[model samples]
Target chain A: MILKSAEAKPHIVVIGAGAIGSFYGAILKRAGCAVSVVLRSDYETVKASGFRFTSPLGDLSWTPDHVYQPGETPLQTPDYVLLCVKVLPGVDRAELVRSWLGNHTALVLIENGLDIERELADAFPDNPLLSCLAFIAVSRTGPGTVNHQAYGQLVMGNFPKGFDQHCEQLANLFREGGIDVNGTDAVVGERWRKCVWNTSFNPLSVLANGADTLTMLDAPGGEALIRLMMKEVIAVAEADGYPMPPDIIEKNISGTRAMGAYKNSMALDYLNDRPIELEAIVGNIVAIADRLDVPVPHLRTVLVTLRIRQGVDSAHSE
Target chain B: MILKSAEAKPHIVVIGAGAIGSFYGAILKRAGCAVSVVLRSDYETVKASGFRFTSPLGDLSWTPDHVYQPGETPLQTPDYVLLCVKVLPGVDRAELVRSWLGNHTALVLIENGLDIERELADAFPDNPLLSCLAFIAVSRTGPGTVNHQAYGQLVMGNFPKGFDQHCEQLANLFREGGIDVNGTDAVVGERWRKCVWNTSFNPLSVLANGADTLTMLDAPGGEALIRLMMKEVIAVAEADGYPMPPDIIEKNISGTRAMGAYKNSMALDYLNDRPIELEAIVGNIVAIADRLDVPVPHLRTVLVTLRIRQGVDSAHSE
Candidate 1:
């Protein structure tokens, strides 16, 4: 199934060479796995200079086994398919990877949003799927540069639960890659827990642009809004059949306070004028809240404000 | 008694010669009134080159009767004192204007805010206070230049009641100055009416920086928020003993829509890095809403966000 030994290295085709994809690809390469990447803006550069990774552990540069653009066909089917693209609404992602993915390949999705695994799993029900959570602070600084500022780990489990040997094999690949890879039987709980942090900080960081986690918390009355957002997320998650913990709000607040000044991905995206991960992160929760008849004024406000910004931008373009 | 004739021009003291004061002073001067100004930033420039008025009506440049700093005492009390300063909290306004105001000087308090009349009236009980509102698109472009783009009028009334002879006289002065002046027995009601627009646009224009009125209105969910703000303002005003009409929200929305692209004074102030009149314009309404036990979550959120911006600015300064 997965990687048996270092001699027979599993070949991985990384579908998105973003910060997450690059980080994982570099780690997998270091773990003695054959890694190839399909990139958007970084194909030419990565093919030339390779990936330059800067983490707290150390810094290293390495070239993957191969790099290809979207149109470039794969001559061979890889053992694992890693999907790390930004999951904005209206993108046909299942269609994007179908050309290279075969029946025998397993897919690992390491994204920071809600309900991202549904489409891929539905597209390939027979294929092995490991829904993964990448708890790492990473950013693609340049063409071949990946900066990991803080936490780095992979919390993975069998898609729809109950870990098998395949889960162990895939996670062991990451473990052998010089990063912690923890397994959980309750992946939905982990997703909700991750959403608890993402929903609170992501949109607020974008809306409250240029402010970090602590700076936003220190904002006047911001502490209350942040806390309310966390509570609302937990409530919405519960209503949606995956409840977060009771102490999660206090825990998140104190934990973020300790993280000091850190900009979430949404903030970075907004600053870079990239499309925000609104629907995947905040909109999904709001949709669930709407379906469940739960009032999440704070979260709803963030959603509406972002819609306004998007509307303004579109109007400007037209 | 009021002025006997147009030939007997009223002498008025214009304190706080910013945009509002300068505009009113220029208008009063155009109406054949002798206007003396106490200026802060524009003193030297205005002294060197008198005010240049560029309105849709005409163009004119004229020096006021006198220009003095705040420390410079007036030789004598004038017939009227136009208090056009920003009505922010924490400053002793009464004491600031005490030296220039005397028994017969009817002070027309031209400001944009809630609960402004009480303090001035309380501080100078015997003085005739005309609570006034300016409905116009005007801004000070430079040191001695005012840009009057659209809709110019003065809606005024006696501080606590029906129009007195002084109010009539002041109304006539503005009328002769080529501007319409409307009088009402219910000044508070009119204030609430004006607030329907101010509350919707002012802070939003600032917070949603670079966004004019229509752009904000055209924002995806801005229509609902704007309408809700108008409704909440009406409710708060009613709780404060001043009931606006039922269809005022629609009326305000349509009126603002028709205004096309116009930035509120608060927005201009924010863009220029000048301090916003948060306490005077929005905070006072939120306070009243709190007192009346009215749940105005939207307005309260606006208040808090502005406070957050203010807090961030203060922290940056420190």
Candidate 2:
């Protein structure tokens, strides 16, 4: 049931509340906003005990105001619905958010990959779509438990351009929860920048048989391979009219080295037999490169190998 | 002990007698040569029952005249010593062959990969170094038992260039044993031609998680990936002064499709945890491409991923 109040407070609904969503939703809740969650696997545990977060930002036990399973009707109208699910195969993001889209609800997608906003934008042309990039080291330790190991900075903006009041409001709410948030006019550019890392390490980690970032980086020619892929991605970005900064590759490499031994999200998914985000992360980037007549052999090679793996795996299952 | 013969025959010592060496050594023995083998893992089985072959070229069970273990001294080292071991990480081909190099024994290398002869050539400057490439589908089903499925052709020549009497004599002997053998003056060029297929498929099969030929070809974008890798290899070949035939890519693709669900040797090695010839196959190709400043990102990508797998596997063992 919707909570009745003398005055309506800003309400946020978190879709796909695994780790990123649950953590961010808790932060918004701490900022005095009413936060709800849509969950699948962790629905029972989270509904019973709420969320126990052991984080460097200080441990917190947050209980979402409302816990809703997927396929349920929209119980309350939300001012913002945070789409935080992985963009994997069979995940129709636009369809997932369609039923929950109220007239004034602005959808914010805090996910990985390039060219992710087009589907939602096409489905709801009038609704404001904000895209976000999360640079955080967080993982779900168990059901309803999240462990945040490192940085949690977020950059978000309006879909095709300029920042709006909705973006500003969300950024302020996130900041109030004690994490850094940047509301930029160039969110797409920021995505390309982040993709320079994602498109390389994510697929490489899986391809290397669940190797950690440092294992890959320390292997002979591993660093060069990463550098070449990043260069190809930067070329694709440049061709797509979003040229990255001059030192982006060095910055990315050094940043990854500083992160120590860490397995990327896709690698973890692969090891756990969960579907990886190949299309959204690498495939779309390769497609853009192909359309722009840019040569991205490294990216294409990774895409092809990963696709072959998926095909072989499905064939075995069949 | 040397076999006492009233009439002396060509004494052929076969080193690294796994599958390819065993089959070819059997064929040579069938051609009325005194064929001996150097075996490690299969020595007992081979010494007891010899080899049982099942091939469309006509099955034959032929016993070796002698089976010598590793570290044994030179035993009647004669006209030829065929080295057929895999060029894996720990294999020292030069050291393995050094003790058996008789003064008159011409060393014939029936192995895969380019630049493989340099180590032997550097070691035995006085003896004739003949390099041969085998295009065959052969596997050891059990110890001392080989199943030769298809095409057993041999291409042999002198190290630098020019066909000699030794090459012609070996070719004739192979032809007598019911297989085609081409003695070429441009054997290096022929190697580059064969590498167009090896460099593309071998590492790719492993990277695709032990995918067979048809599985890889039929996967979405798989054929395109192979074609791209083939083109890069061709580019490297051309840069290295060996321009391949115009239809090499198409011919290779079609020939592979006709092979029907074959897993390359490297893929089989990977699946069985046997040491793969990554350095000899994809690594050398990339090295040549890098030296020539050729853009072989596809090949380089495959090399990098495989190297990472090697690193990760070794780390786990440690």
Candidate 3:
């Protein structure tokens, strides 16, 4: 029951218009798809000015056809839903996605790490889910601007069926929108590979209270520790039946080294004295390793140190 | 034999008159000691304006009788030399001390750690070596002004000998000059005890990349890592036949907690992107543990991480 090329454009609803969400939404809008974004009230400036995308390929700007808050508008489920929120523990995402989920909705998650897909599936079992691994260094500069620091393609795949025509249709839509989308059966492996990079590099950046460049390039024992953490991650992934290849891990490490002077989000949060998304980034890795009977000694040590640094056990006095 | 109280004051030389050195030199001058300081040319502002001490106890100013650079002055050994340089690797401290080491010279190292005493002893075994544990929160405000942040006290003793009469005389001089100088038989032990506090807290502060209060009070597991690092240090000290009591360690931790919003020197260095004294603080502890056959897993991890952080292998690039 796939729609043909002569039919009207598919309606896409992009929730949480942060940097990545905005980037994809702008691209889709430029390609003649009807795109709408649900954003916070604070992002009114973005709605007014439209989004400006500066990339190595070229610069472009796009204004969404519609912008609405979660509860303010009479909602209609779109043909496609893209969830782009900062994933943290205790997030009420299931309830947030309830009104947006319809019989025909296809959802794609563009957040960091894995397990969120499982969490979503557990909550909304009947809905379709697709996982995406974004390699671009996109960050929001202002209300309606995303600074793409580096250029890379997106690898996506079907969640429940492993890979099918639905995944191809979605990839075709992204391709029409000028996004380099690779739809593959190995999407789960791709997501886990990205997880290995995040788990090893992100927490170390936070704990060292330094930039990514410092952690990857300068810190002693940093590279060795990163390799060890990645090795443990790969071991756990293999035990769980979704291991990353050695070459991919090496490429990820090398990519980070090449991006000199860029501070990871975790390090930025630490410098600003904000609570980190530790559980999602590193704690989950430790928990998974334990479940799979894999020894992640280096990650565990770093986890304990980060917890101590954050004062995890002490009751808040104020 | 101790020199009797006479009409003329004994000559005292203070090396590295930045803050702590200037504070002591100013006080010594006030107490009728002929104080001369060897300082860098950049500290000409302090030399021009004299030295100002701002403390809760009282405020005072003193103009030193003489000031000279490392090689500018004619060679002459003083009765006492107070070494106050910040510890760094390959600093050639032995050679620096040699220029001022006369037969009767009593060299007292009032620096941050205990290893300097061993370094001095190894360099000039015959000269009387005095080890001092200085507890003060003082910093240079300008060329000649030092801000006494909070507390100040000195625990001093002679190595390889019980309280020498000269030690008692120096203690009397410091006491008369309004300094809390405690002469103990186990000054080396006291020095290591202070190090246990620093080795645990200083690096944690640097790694946490926040004020002492945040790590000590606000963060979870903050105090636990402090305790764990201290435990490793204590084990190493005991293996070297100088066992530190749990109570002393507890007091140091509690004292740090009480002094909220304080930033350690290492944290300041990291913030300013200056080189840190990693070897003097954490590396020396690791070196000692290795030599003594003590397994210091926690310390080893921290040491390696710090070495990576500073790009110790690629120091020239920094």
Candidate 4:
């Protein structure tokens, strides 16, 4: 059902108030969608003084029309719940968001990492499930403040079918909000393409111990390593029948190089003494490669050290 | 040809009085050989108080017969010049001890890493380079003080031919000092065997940013990575016609596991801001593998990052 105007505007409940969640939710709200973001520690501060969005284009300040925790919101069932929480290990994501998941509420995961949809899909199969790959350069510099540094493109697709009417409607909502959304049936391919950069550089940035991207690229064999790792990712993706572009390696490298002196999310978390999203990022690649009998030696070697750094001795274990 | 009496005792000059040099030189002095150690910053304190040897068996303190700077040492041509300095990039190993090299002076290298003797042998062909792989656990905890930890075994073998009377004589000299030194006809084999541990754990320890052995091993996939890297080393060694034992993997693992908790030399140097030995330890293995057309991907992967950490983009160059 293509809802239009006033009553037709779908309400989106942003599940996590981090950078992506806040920025996107604010954008959606500004674009006439009923956007409600769950405010945690900054509930009072953000609720009272509102929040700030510092982007290249301009700055915006607005109080959210609806602000409440899960189950505290006045709406019985939000049209959609956009999850932006980090898919790290030991997070009982299903349980944490149980209160917000109404019977028919569609769940859109605007998160990073691979193979993340299975659990939630299994738990709430009836509700529509969408996997979103965020290609935005955004950061939560301070409490309730999001700094949109660079890109803000989001690629999404509905589960199993990859694309459906719901996916189109959601993509339309995002496009109207000025998000530059891309709807694709090849969600897996899109993810693998993004992983080309994430797998190559995220943990490496962590290993660099908060060294920015430029400094990391400055390391001898470092830039070449990025290309090699990206090529490796491409190989695995091709093996899994989700082939990406021939020049994907160059494209990813140039893209990251253009990011210019940015510290990746993994490095930022590492520097702040918080756990990075290990399972969703590198571990899934290793797992999938093992399942396919593909030799991913470079990924294995780097992942082993990365796991050790994260104090995780074993990966993909229950 | 082993001399027994003091009148026929061979004079030895020990260069680089760090842990390995100080401990071994002191042991030679204790065994009645005329030993003169070239001192650096530790010169004055060691010269004033002599030196203290704190071994597991017992502690011994003694003043040296002669201690001086490298160029100021009295002996023009000592029987042996023990080189224990790190073979890192930019260090002129030959030129550092050019003044000590005499026509008949046998140069003994009690150091870590692989293929280290090739250059020195090329530089001074007639010096009879004796490569001693120190399996002993000893460290210079402070100036003029050495701590003898777990193992105290030295494997000495003559280069090129490996087995010679000089090797056996050096073994005997160490034996008289209560050191358990073994002479082998397989110097390359011994170095490769030690490289099993060094290549696997050394760079990793550095990458861990000075995390000690146990801490490193305790990390997830840490032990498995050690085995994998060791297997890769063995493959390269076997291809190069230096076939190590089939059970070398198990032996190396058990032996390192038995070391309990100790930081490898690379980690120690990294923590102290001193340059870690990259060329000799990892770079040599990589070079030999490349020469032999053997793929040692794991070692290559680790070495690339390790080189960056050591501030070396490349090795063995001006």
Candidate 5:
């Protein structure tokens, strides 16, 4: 479904005002869009001082045109609703943004993992559902504070395929705000590319008990295990009709090696006793593999370990 | 070399008097053998009050005929030296028992893991070396106390091949002491059989953060992961010419399920921050698989996770 562009200065609503949501919303606002933010944990702080972002794309302080606490409706209809929450289990994402979604408001999910757009697409049949992948190193350091370590390019497309007029307009707005954006027709394939790295490093970091990228790669038999897991992912992808480039595994390994001692976010989540996106990141791939009858023993083993740990962790908390 | 039976009462010396050593030494003494134990940490307490055993075989308290500290030589040359220490990476097992071995003494290793007899075989070229596997559930509750939960069967054979008269002599001694004994010529195959269980549960328990058998088996994808790892072990064993029985994996799973909530030894070692037997158990299997050109991606993946965790854990302690 190709979506048409809205008026010149469109109103943008940010559903989750965390790192990715806050960063991209501020970028759109810099292009003269009227931005409103919805926040819970950092509502008071953001309402008081707004957000301070430190990024290579140019540091800036962004105060939303309007701020609304969760469960409160915005006064103006939004042109776009950016969903940037972590894709964790037990969160009904479609219901989270139902109140703010207007008739023409295109839902853009600038998040991780695959098949994340299905629920929202099912909920709002007429709305343009844009699935996005944010290739950026950003984290929320403190209340209303964001730190962008590296890269800030976004790849986005319509629900299942094709770039539309609205996607082009959004890209132009991001370019005007000094951030690079790519409108791709094959954004789902791009997700598989990203998963080549995510599936190997994310759970491995936690399993290593909070090891960094290099620590995982440098340990005995670490590189081989990572390669085996990456091959499993590739097999699943290929069997699902998205064969990756021959050099993708090598590129991911060398790329992670260059990142030095960066701890993947899932490891940080596990260390901080927070819920992780185990289901979205690795579980879906294994599920697909099971359907395809493509054996993915390596990924399945790691997935089970993460599941047990997550289960036991939540059980203890309860 | 075949070993003839000793005089009416054989002189047996036990080294590394932890759980296995203590239990077996007490049993030998019950059969009227003159047993002497070498102690380290529990020397004073054991010398003062001896050991107390609680087992289905029978409950009894027995003091050793002689108790010598480490580095002290017993007055009489032992007919058999029992080595029951943990097969960790460091603390050379051969060197630890070097001072206790004599010209006529046979070294019996009642330990867990594979390829564990090679070092002792090299160290004592002329002396008899018997490799034995203890299928028992026992733990040292206190300095000089042991709690045996179930099963006290010993599988023994001469190292690297055929059983000799000493195997028969030792089996008779164990039988007289009210313990079950199986003296097989195919002990290496038996080691592989034991590994079908150890390679899966031991490392997996630690990976689950000290979870017991039921917790591991009950979690989603847990049993499948265990089965995958067990299959890999079987593959390696078959490639190396010791194919397991068809029902080995099922037998192991059901046996563990009936054990209630049992934490494996490696998991307990991890919980207590002691060194694990990762090398002797899973590492050697992977090494053999590598040499045999048999792919064991599941075992290799789990092996690297355990290695990194063990390495990171030791580093943090240092």
Candidate 6:
């Protein structure tokens, strides 16, 4: 399943030109792959200015070779589609993917949380879908500009199945673009591992108002509490039959402390008064816990607190 | 015990001329009580402008009989001293109370949290130390003015033993001054119960940035998280032999929601960027949990998050 040099570049379509999608598309374009970005009304700004990426590796700016709008532009049915939109409520996001998905098209999900892929899989059982865990601190600082605060490799693989040649070929395409891509057979485990970190830290940072480092270090009983919450997450993950390694939890905790001044995306949303990804993050965790019949008191507590903060009642009628 | 009205009213010294002290002093003055104020140098404006209370009960403005600094005042122990200063870290606040505590003196501890009374009880074992829970949402709108948001009653009682005559007498005095007073024998329970409310709502409000009602209602899973945290607090309280009723927790939640646009004290502290009362509220809860060998996973998580937020470590070092 390992891809070598000189393979035919796949035509990749990145949905939603956010930080993650822009990062991926711009890099793929530099790797000699034909990249198409589907954008909104702001497409002209991005096309004219291109995407400015400031990373530790170096800085680069590039405009995608092709652009498309959902209804206006007729899509060519890309060889691969990267779903990069933030999870907005009531949006039939799966249908949007279906528009660009073809028989040979492989869908890679780069969004936060674990359940989106499962939902997509259920909706399109025959579609070849891969789940990816991104470990980078990326944000859109301005129009057509993304600031890469931190850099880590992307861990991705085919879900529920072993890695195939297509997955490796895509991984190779990412690697050629200077992305540290790890093609794992245990994509679910990796996603759950990432979830452990997200569920424990993201809302906490948001609730504490961009004080992730303090939450990790100085909060009264903070370290102990995070450990307990993560322990619950690990338990839930194990009960769900995709047990993440103990070291994964430890690594996340340590990595969070090491992150020091990095504010989580949830905190950013709260600051900007944007609707949070509460359903995908906290709500999904509770749903999974209910499904697995595991007691997740701490996670449930955080979830409820976040839900109330977001003004959604128990009925979630909003 | 109820106090029989006497021809000569007893002299009261309000130590700490902050918002609460000023409100009480102004009310007592209007009620024909002889009151003096001990305040910091920064509170000179209160002396110049007298004191004003704009409350739902009624608005009043009056200058106290005298305003004295700590060292400038003649040292004559009064019948009662209302200790109203914030709990500054490392300061032996209880010892500061000792200077004003005479054999017959009654001291009311009004700061947020529980253990301060315990510390005072250890110091002044003989004197009548009344622990009070103030429910009025009084904020110092100006130097000598307080804007009372709501008119909730104050609960007060003596320590260790059941309510004595002195507790009732103070309750009567407050009642005479148009303050709703609930004199109870279960002062300890009252304090712990108030702690439960403060611990749950205050930090959440501060973290969410003055949106307690919305955050508690709208934030995904916020209510559940708050309920879980309350359960943890109740468990710790029970283990410490101060079990709060579930109804009280429910009332606190409903009361907070009812407060609507009002901001909690923690939110005020955060807005002012002042040092938070983390130790008094969240810290004491964690400490008591450890002491009683009860698990408070949710409280611990939030406490840690807030601690990092306040830069408590650096504050401690300073």
DockQ-best of 1 and 6: 1
Model 1: residue B94 alpha-carbon error in angstroms: 3.4
DockQ of 4: 0.41
User: How well does chain A score by TM in each candidate?
Assistant: 0.93, 0.94, 0.88, 0.89, 0.95, 0.90
User: DockQ for model 2?
Assistant: 0.80
lDDT of 5 by residue, A96-198 (tens): 8999998898888988887677788899999988888988888889999999887779998887888998898888988888788988898888888889889
- Kindly list the per-residue Cα lDDT of model 1 for residues A63-135, writing each as its tens digit: 8778988987776788888888889877788877788788888888888788778888899998888788998
Top model by TM-score, which number? 2
What tens-digit string does per-residue lDDT give for candidate 1 at B166-259? 8998788887777888998778788888888888688766656546787778776688777877788889998889987778887878887786
Per-residue lDDT for B223-300 in model 3, tens only?
665677788889888887788775876787677667656778777766666567778778888788989898765666
lDDT of 2 by residue, A6-50 (tens): 125588899999889988898888777899999999999999999
How many clashes does the backbone of model 1 have?
A: 0
Q: How big is the RMSD of model 2?
A: 2.6
| Fraction of native A-B contacts kept, per candidate | 0.24, 0.80, 0.30, 0.36, 0.66, 0.55
What does the lDDT come to for candidate 4?
A: 0.78
DockQ, cand. 6: 0.37
* Angstrom error at residue B131, model 2: 1.6
- Which DockQ value does candidate 3 get? 0.22
List each candidate's DockQ score.
0.39, 0.80, 0.22, 0.41, 0.65, 0.37
RMSD of each: 3.2, 2.6, 5.1, 4.0, 4.0, 4.6
Cα lDDT tens digits for candidate 2, B1-318: 234441355779999998899889978877778888998999999999899999887866788888999999766866899999988767889898988887878999999988788888888999998999998989989998889888889988999788988998888888877889988998899889989998999899899889999988988899999999999999999999999889999999999898689888888888898888898888888888889999888888889998998898878888
TM-score (0 to 1) of chain B for each candidate: 0.94, 0.94, 0.90, 0.91, 0.94, 0.90
Worst 10 residues of 5 chain A by lDDT: A1-10
For each candidate, the alpha-carbon lDDT, in order, equals: 0.81, 0.88, 0.73, 0.78, 0.87, 0.74
Score residue A48 of candidate 3 by CA lDDT: 82
Top candidate when judged by DockQ against the true structure? 2
